[model samples]
Target: MRQITAILVGAGARGRFVYGEYAKKYPKELKIVAVAEPNEERRQLAAKDHGLSSNQLYESWEQVLDGAVMADVAVISTQDRMHCAPTIKALELGYDVLLEKPMSPLSEEVNTMANASRKYNRLLTVCHVLRYTPFWSKIKEIIVSGGIGQIVSIQLSENVGYYHMAHSFVRGNWNKAEETSPMILQKSCHDMDILSWLIDQRCTKVSSYGSLLHFRPENAPVGSTLRCTGGCVVERECPYSAVRIYEEDDPCNEWNRFITNKLTPEGIREAIEHGPFGRCVYRCDNNVVDHQVVNMEFESGSTASFTMSGFSHDISRTVQIMGTLGEIRGYMEKSEIVLFPFGGEAIEVPVTVEEGGHGGGDEGLMREFLKQVRNENSNDDQGLTSAEASLQSHLMAFAAERSRLEGGKSVTIAEMMELQFTQVKGVASPNKVT
Candidate 1:
């Protein structure tokens, strides 16, 4: 067996979880040899949690790659803006890369990263995990089987629950549009990627409109501070109380125990007060849209609508597809597919969940990624969305943001790509992180 040593950049929540799985589940196939993080505390926690020796820790990716060819692969799960540098560096250092999605905060960076992968002839896979889910695979199969013939339109809406959106974009790292683009790019790029893959078409133009209506600093109710549970008069009415929501053992909580326990209660208190989540739900520095609608036209003569809302009652995606002969409606979480023929009643099709993150795509993604890395035969037995396919969809969000800001003008995919190419061609790639 080829022993593949891996390095994890960003010792944050998702990075730690992926590293944990590598350590516990696929120890024989992949070994986490090192970690790079600028955050001293997070670095230490990751080292302690993953049992890394001092020699295996680095303050930055530059330090890790400095005369050290220790990792067979570099997992780039850093901030959106920081993705391109480390990933390109990893490839330059003769390591394959598994990049986390949205590719980068800016379209130019994404093109540069893609260019580096091609230039280096390295296996650079983005973590577009949706292509790995069992439910999505079934959906794709149904569509390919012509469960709805000659597809013409698709309506996909993401219900990014109030708490989830608040936790991630409101109080999290994705609050600012300049820093992250719209919530569309930051959160829905995955959906966009999957949608493009499902339709097998290039998005020609996109026009989007949305705004941060609810979670603004000015929208805080009477007598409410940043945090709802702390001293707000409406604490009883708000459901996002840090105490009530996070006190018990939940999936998100368990996911963070490795790091959360390291923070003292007072530390947590201070963070909540100062962090994005601690802000009033109706009042924050967040500029990303809480509710958005995007109209897209695909090159294949099909149309699509994408809606993302933060105030949804639940976390699920409801999709509708219209075709020449029939129509299909499905829910991602429920895993149900219903087809309505042009002249007949609806028929039910079954869909079920696998068992990990994002409707069980995490594990399925790992399976395919590992198989590919190990040179094992892998197939779309359970649908697998490739890097190029996923990248096309993710880029739509960036294009849509441009459209949204430019008075709802239609932005062409080709135009956006040309702009990115020009910008990246002018920028020199960073020196290998070493």
Candidate 2:
């Protein structure tokens, strides 16, 4: 197999750890030829890891794109707001793109990106990694096979672990909705995509309710300081203490390394004392909801309810699907799927949970993306997640957010798309498609 060369746009955690690491493990299958990262340390680290020469290293994405096109694919793992321009430019430059999700925070931008992909005839796959996992894939197969008959309803919950919520939302980069995006788009877009994919129908309407409930100053323990390193009174008991989570003497595991590059005790202590990760969860500038519930009505008249909470003990997705003939219940963490047939014996399907991030979804998606780019696996059975197909989920999320803010008024997907089209009519080119 000819190796597929790639240029990385962002050398952040997702760029380097999730997507770019595939090049390291499968050197014969893929290669990272160039990298564009503003951070000097990260650029050097990525260059050294990918064995790229100095000429291949760029200080910014604009610099990489300013020169000639260098690779077959561009792994665009930039921040949410930064996805649109680079993605469209890469497609125009004759490079297939693997974009990190929530594709863009704005629906119009996502639509524009999708249109560019169609116009350029370039592959644009979003990193909806959950769809590539064996656990969810099996469920999809069972549903499609009529194991549960026609889908009637789905109840899904994404339980964001408390520590993770603190690390990413409270004290990390995605803390503010105004800056990054809403909690739904930033974190739960994966769930929304999964829900839409499983139902196999467009989301017609959505209603939601949520808030930034407990992670506020009023709920903080008395005598708690602004930062965990500020000698808080409840540092020992607080689960979200920055010092306890990041400054511990834990081994540098794959997950920990991705969060904070500084793994040593002293390094972690210094980061906490100076970085955003050290701020008290209750005292951060976060405005996104800590918990949310969305009710979706698909075009097929099937209903689904999704709940995202930041206070779970474990980070996992639990789903229950009801059909005309039976029902399916699954716990993503346990990798167990149970089928209950009407007046029949229950069937319990054992799912082999792969060992890696997102239940091995990161590697699964990377492999599928490489195959797609190489034209090795063109069949639909490969479950390739295209940018166009993933757009509905993002639209659904945008509508859900609107509904949530509008006092749970039911928001139709068509209305959201139409609004986006009108809003971007002057800005977006004439390649719009329904």
Best by lDDT: 2
Q: What TM-score would every model get versus the actual structure?
A: 0.89, 0.95
lDDT of 1 at 276: 48
- Candidate 2 local lDDT, 1-434, one digit each (tens): 88999999999988988777888988999999999999998999998898888999998888888768898999999888899999999989989889998888777788899889888888888999999899999999999999989999999999998888887887778888777788998999999999988999989999999999988888989989988879798998888777667666433122345445667767766777877878888888888899999999988799999999999887889999999999999999889999998889999998877966899899898888888888833324323578778888988888888888888899888888787888678654322211
State the C-alpha lDDT per candidate.
0.74, 0.85
Question: For model 2, what is the C-alpha lDDT against the true structure?
Answer: 0.85
Q: Check candidate 1 and list the clashing pairs.
A: 62-433, 171-276, 171-277, 216-282, 216-283, 216-284, 217-283, 217-284
Off by over 4 Å in 1: 1-3, 248-259, 263-276, 341-346, 376-387, 425-434
Top model by TM-score, which number? 2
Least accurate 10 contiguous residues by lDDT in model 1: 376-385
